[model samples]
Target: MDLLKTPAFAAHVESLLKEHHTPGVSIAIVHDDTFSSAAFGKSVISSDAGSEERDCTPDTLFDIASCSKSLTAAAVALLVEDDVNFPNVKWDSKMSDLLPEDFVLEKDEYTRDVTIEDILSHRSGLPSHDSVYMGTKAKRPDTAKSITRKLRHLPLAKPIRSSHMYCNLMFTVATHLIETLTDKTFSEFLQERIFAPLNLTSTFLQPSSVPPADRDSRLACGYSYRESTSTYHAIPVFDTPEDQGAGSIITSVNDYIVYVHALMTHAPPFTQAIQKALVTPRFALPEYNDDRERLQSSTLIGLGWEIFYYRGHRVVQHDGSISGLTSTHFFLPARNFAAVILCNGDAGYPAVAALVRELIDQTLGVEPSQRLDWPEIFTRGRGVRGEAESEDADGEQKNEEEKAPSSIDTAGAKDMAELTLADQPEKERGSEEKYIPPPFPTSDLPLDRFTGEYHHAGYDSFVVGVRASPEGGEALFIDAADRCMGFGIALEFVCRAEAGGDASSPSPSEVKFLAYLTDVDECETEILEAVFVVDGDDRTDAGGKIGKARRLGINLDEDIEGLIWFERV
Candidate 1:
C-alpha cells in the first residue's frame, strides 16, 4: 500500500518537482516483499534569497553517479568468487594478462584482446574519451593505475569486440583491476567488499569518504539551474577520488534500498552464480539507443547492468550523472520489483526519469491510459527542457515561433573547474573582453609563434597563449587546464591551409584556428578545430623566422579521428 503514501503518489512527485526546476527527490520502492519510501523537496537549494533550506530525507547522501557501475560490477563479481585471490581472474581474464603495464590498448590487437568480459560488457572499443578525464586534477594526478595507463594514448572508436562503447575509461579499468587483483583500494575494496557485506551504512567511497558527522547532516546538496537567474545554485561536493571504478559511489535512499534489496532478495553477496554472471545478455543497445516510447525493448548490456524490456517486465536498470546528482537504479527480475530514485537538481533527470516511469506504472498494475506522461513529455518545449512552454488546455503560453531550438543544457555540468565557473554573473562571464577576433581578415604566423606547451598523450597538456582582443588585437587563447569545464578557450583565426582549397593556393606553412567550444554558462557552441603544424626541416630557424610552433591539431573527441596530434611541449 505504499505507492508513495498515495495522495495520487504524492501529487505525482510534486508535479515532477514543479516540472523540473527540481529542488529535490528521494523515492525507493520494493513492491511484493513490500518496502516503499519517499522524500520530496529541498536538500539544500540556496542561491541566496535568505539561504537555509535543507529537507530531502530518507537518509539523504547521493552521488551514485554512473550508478557506481553496479558496485563496480558487484566488485568484479567478488573477484569472480575469490578463487584464492583471483587465481587467474576470470570474466574472460586477458586484459593483456590482467595488467601488463596497465592494460595497454590502441591495438596490439586491442592490446592482446581486451577482457574482464571486455570491460564489463561495454565491449571495449572505448569511446567516451570524456575529454580525457576532464581537467585531470588541474595539473596532473590521475590514478586508477594512471587512468589505466591512459589507455595507451586513446583512439579506438570500435573494433575489439566491436560495439557498446559506453566507457568511463573502462570503469577506470575496473579501478585498475580491483587494485591489481585485490591488493585492495578501490576504496578499500568497496569498503570491505560491497559496503561491509551489504549493511551499507549510508555507503561511501567518496564525498571524501563521508564521515565528519555524516558529512554535514547526511550529505545531499547538489544542484544547478541558472537559466539567466531563475536561480537554484548550490553544486559543490565533487570528490571523485579518480573515479574509482567509474563514477564514485556515495549512496542513500536508505543506503540504496539495501543495495536494491540485495539485488531483489537474492541477498548474500547476490550469489546465484553472482546473479547469472551479473545478468548475462552482453551487447545489442544501438537501435538509436532504443527507447521507443519507453517500453524499452531488448536493449541489453549486462555486467554493469542495463538489461531492458519494461512492459514485458525483465527490466534491470541503471542511470546516473555526477555533478549535481541524478540517479535511478530500478530492478524487476520478473517483478520481484525494486526502485530507488534519488535526485538533486541539474534539472533532476526529468524528475528522476519520471519517477522511474511512475514507479514502474505503480508496481505493474499499469493502466492509467497506459502510463507515460513523463511530466508531459519532459515539460513540452522551452526547446525541450529549460522549460517555459507547456500550457495550453486553454491556459495559453506556447508559441515563441512554436519554440524548440535552444538545446545546450549540460545538466549540472562540472567535471572540474568548479561548476562551470560558479554561479555566473561577473557581467556574464567569458572575460578578457571575450577575446574573439580574427574571423579571417587574413594574417599568418605571429600570434606569439603559436605560444607554448601542447602535448596530448590522452589529453594532458594545454597552454597556447595571447588574449586581449575584443578587437584591441592579439587573440587566440585556450588555457583548458581543467579542460572545457574551466572554459577559457577562445582562439578564432579560422583557416590558412585546407578548408575548401585553392583561393590562390600558396598560404601553406600551416595555420588554421577556430575554437568556440562554450560552456561558459551555455548557449551551445562546439566549433574547435586548431591545427598549427610545421614539423619538417623544423620549418625555419637558422634565423629564417616563423619557428616555435611544431605540431598541434585538435578534435577533442568528436567521436575521435583525424586530429588529437598535440606534441610540441
Candidate 2:
C-alpha cells in the first residue's frame, strides 16, 4: 500500500492547508532502513507578486531552524573522534581556555568554567539574548567574543547546570569555539567534513550560499497569517545570525535522508563508535511538563538529541521553529524507523500536526478511525496569531508592548518578556508621548555600588553601577552612550538614610531605574521613562567563584518585573 498516496493522508493534508492557509510542505519517512519523501504545493503561492509558482520538490530547500542543533551536535561528535591531538577541542575543557586570550567574563566565574557538554545539554545557565543575533546588526563568529566580555554583565537564569533553559546563545558560543579550534567558519568545516562525506549537496548553512538558480526559485518563502485581514503576508528571511550553529540550517528531505542514515548507521567515512555515542542521554530535563500535566515522553536531553521512551519504544528527536517554518525529526533506533516534516508556514501548524499523525500511523498497530484535528491541539507552532497573550510559548506568558513601527520589524517587541522572570504589567495601548514618567526626574541618594553592567534577555545589556543615572543629576556629566540608570518609583523610590536617594523609606533594599519604550541606545525627545527599582545592602560583594562584583538586591523596571541582581564588571 502506498501510504503517501492514500486517500486518507491526502485528505488530511488538504484539509490542514485550507484551514491554516499554509502554502507548502515536505514530508520524509524512513522505515526498515529505507526512505521515501514527497513535497506538496508551490514553494510560493500562485498570487505572490514577485515569486513564481514552482512546486516544492523532494529536494526543495527549507530552513531546518533549530534542527541544526542536532546536526551541529553530530559535527562536535565527529570532531571529538579526531580531537586526540587538537589541544583546544576537549568536550570537558572550559570555554575560557578555548576562547581568545582577551575574552573574559570578569564577574561570572561560572561563565569561564562552562564545558562543551554544558552547551549541548542546555545547562549553561544562559537564556536566549537573541536580540543581539536578530535583525540587520547580527554578530556572527564574533558573537562568541562579544558574549565572553558581556556575559559577566548578564545575569544567570539559573545556577550553572542547575536547570535547563534551552539557550541558543550557548550553542553560538560552541560554534564560535569550534571555529576558533578548526580555524574555519562552522559552515566551511561541516561542508568539508560531514556533508561532502555523505554526498548531501542540497544542504546549505546560509541561504545566500544556496545555488543562485534554486535560491530564487525553489527556496521556500515564509509567511504569517494576519487575523485582521484573514490573509497571509510574506515575512523576510533572516540570513546572517551567528546562530547558524543553533538554528539556521536549510535543506531538503532527500539530502536530510543522508543525515538520517548517518545517525542510524554511523555511515562510513565517519567514526562508527563516535556516532554511536552521540545519542546517549546526557542531561536530565524536567520529568513532567506542567502544561502537558504528564511525564514527558522524552525527558532527557542527549548530546544534540532528546532521548525518551514512547509507547515502550525508544525514540530520539529534536524540533525547530523560525518565523516561517516549523520542523520535526524523530527516529526510533530500536525499530529502525524515522520521519521528518518541514512545514512552510507559521510556527506550530502542519509540521507538528503531521509529525504526530505520522508517528501514530507508523508505530501503533491500530488505524485511526478518522483524520485527527492536529491544528486543534498543536495550533500554530510558535504562537497563536492575534491572541491577547499566548500561552503556547512552551510555558511562558507573552505580553507584547507594541512599539511604534520601525522601518524594519524586530522580533515581536515583547516576545521574550516571559522567557525571563520579568513581571508583566498590562498598560493601555497608546502613544509613548501621551504616557507620563511619574515625576522620577532626580535622585538625592548616593549611587553607591549601583554602577556596573546590567543585562536583560530581550534588550541586551544596559549600563548601571557607579555614576550613570538616566535622569539629570550626578550622572549628568556621563555621556549618553555610557549612562544606564535605574529610575525608582512611588514608595520604591524611598532610600535608606545612609544611601540617600531620599530619607529612609520602606523597601530599603529596593532601587528603581528609568525605563522607556525607546531603543535605550540614547535619550530621545521627551520620551516617557519606565521606572525600574533595585534592592541591596549598598556594599560590594565578592569572594565568589566567578569574580569581584557588587551584588545588588532584586531590581524591578517599569515595563518588567523581576529580581535583577547586577554584577559589577
Candidate 3:
C-alpha cells in the first residue's frame, strides 16, 4: 500500500491538524522520483457563514518563509559558477569586497573578514536582530540594501565563527550581495536563473507579483489560533521588500516539491558543485536532547539548509515561520526522497513537522514497530524543540516582584509572552498586584522631563510623548507603532530611586516609568520599566527640579542581563 495514500496516514494527518488548531495544510512527498500530493482543510475561512470556504489544494500558494533561503543559496551558487559574469567571485568571496559600501558589521574586523560562505552558513556571529525589521512593514519599507547598511549598528552577540547564530539579517545581506553582483534584483535573478528554468508556475517573490488571474483565488489566507476563544483569527500576510533573500518566497507545495526533487537528484541548475555546497555542513548546531531525538539523531547547518541524520540517512531541511504560516522542507538525497509541508497557521509547525518526520520514516521503510508516533507525542503536550523555544521565548518576562528598569525584547517579547501565559486568566493581563508601582518615593519632577525621542541606532528611535492614560489622566507614552513591536504603549510613573533606607539615603537621580505592552489579541500583557537618568538639578521641585534626561535605560532580552540605554535626542 502507498504510505501517503493509506487511510490511517490520512486520519493521523487530520488529527494532528485538529490538535494544533491549524486550518489548512498541503504536503508533497517524493520517493524514488515518484510524487504524491495531498491537501486538507480550507485555505480561506469565510467570515460570513453563507459564503463558501476556499478549500486548500495543491495549487494554493503559501509564503514559504525561510525555506526561501535554499533558493537564495542556489542562486548564489549559480553566480559563483558563472565565470563569464563573475570571474573572481568564489564561495569565500569577501562580502566587504562584493558589497563594500553596504556590508559593514559592528566590528571593523568582522566587516572586513566576513565572506559569502560566512553569511550563508549563519556563522557571521550576528544574532537574529529580528526586532530591527519584524514589524516595520507598516512604516516606510526598507530595501535589502538599506537593511544590510543597518548591520553596522546592531552589535554581534558573539565573536565571529565562535558559534552558529541563526540571523535573518545575514540572509538579507546575501540578497544585497546578489543584487550588487548581478546588477539585478534578487527576485529577477531567481526568476531568470532558477524558477523560470524549472517551470515553477506557482512560485513568486510576493503575492502581488503572483499571476493576476490566479492571485486572489489561489492564494491562501493565513491565520493564528486564539486559545481563549478556541477560534482562528486571520493575520495579515507578512510581505516586505527587506526580507527578500531571508524569507520572501511565496510558493506552493506543488511547486516546492519540484525544487526539492531537483535537490535530491542533482537536477539541472542543482549541479554537483551546488548540491555539495548546499549540503556540506558548515557548523554544528547546539545539541538538543528533546522529543525530536526519537526521530533524528543529530543536526548541522549547511549554506541555507539544516542537515540532520534521520536514522542513518542524511536529510537536509529548513523550516520557516512568518506571521500566519509555517513551512517545513525535507529531502533525503541518498534515498531519493523529499517532502514539503505548508500550513497556513501561525502555530502549525509542530503538526506539519510531525507529518514530515512520519512521511520520511515511512518512505525509508523503517520498521513500523520502530517508527515514532510524532503526531501523538505532540498531542500529548510535548512539542518539537525549535517550536518550543520559539513559543516559550517570553518565559523570560520580568516577574512582578522585580525592581524597576526591567526590560524585554521589543520585537516578540510581547507576543510570545501572551502565548506562553495564555493558559493564565485573561483579566490578570494587568492585575492590580502586577501594575502596582514600586515602594520607592514618587519623584516631584514633572512628567514632561521624560518626554523626548530616545534613540537606539539598531532599533531606530522611540518617541516618548504625552498621551491620555487609561486612568483618565495625561501620561507619558512611547509611540511605538512604527517600531518593530508594532504597537504603542503607555508609560505610568513608577518611582524614584533611593540609595538606602538609612540616614545616608541620597536623593534620587533616576525616575522610573512602567510600560505595559499588550499582545495584539489583547489576551495578555507584559510590563517593562523605562528609567531616565537626571542630568542636572533644580532645587525648588521635590529635592530639586529634575534636569532633562540625556539617557534612558531599559533591560532588553532577559537571557542577556544589563540595561540598554537609549540616548535622548
TM-score for each model: 0.36, 0.69, 0.84
Candidate order by TM-score, decreasing, is 3, 2, 1
What are the lDDT scores of the predictions, listed in order?
A: 0.67, 0.55, 0.70
Candidate 1 pairs with clashing backbones: 115-118
lDDT over C-alpha atoms for residue 65 of model 3: 83
Best by lDDT: 3
lDDT of 3 by residue, 98-190 (tens): 887888988999999988899998788776766566343334456788789889987676667776667777888888888888899888888
lDDT of 1 by residue, 1-569 (tens): 56677798778788778777878888777766767687888787654445466888878888877888877888888888888867788888888787887788877988888888788777777777666665334668566777788888888877866666667778778878888776877888787777788878888887778888887776777776755546655655656565677777888887788787786677887777887788888776543231323576746778888776767778777787654667878788777888888888766676676667777887788889878677666455223312101222111234544321244232212222233344343221222333122222225457777788887887788777775553465666665535423445656575555333233433335677765554433323445577887545545566555555778887766546678888877
lDDT of predicted model 3? 0.70
The global Cα lDDT (0 to 1) of model 2 is 0.55
lDDT of 3 at 254: 91
The better candidate by lDDT, 2 or 3, is 3
Model 3 Cα shift for residue 567 (angstroms): 2.4
Question: How many residue pairs clash in model 1?
Answer: 1
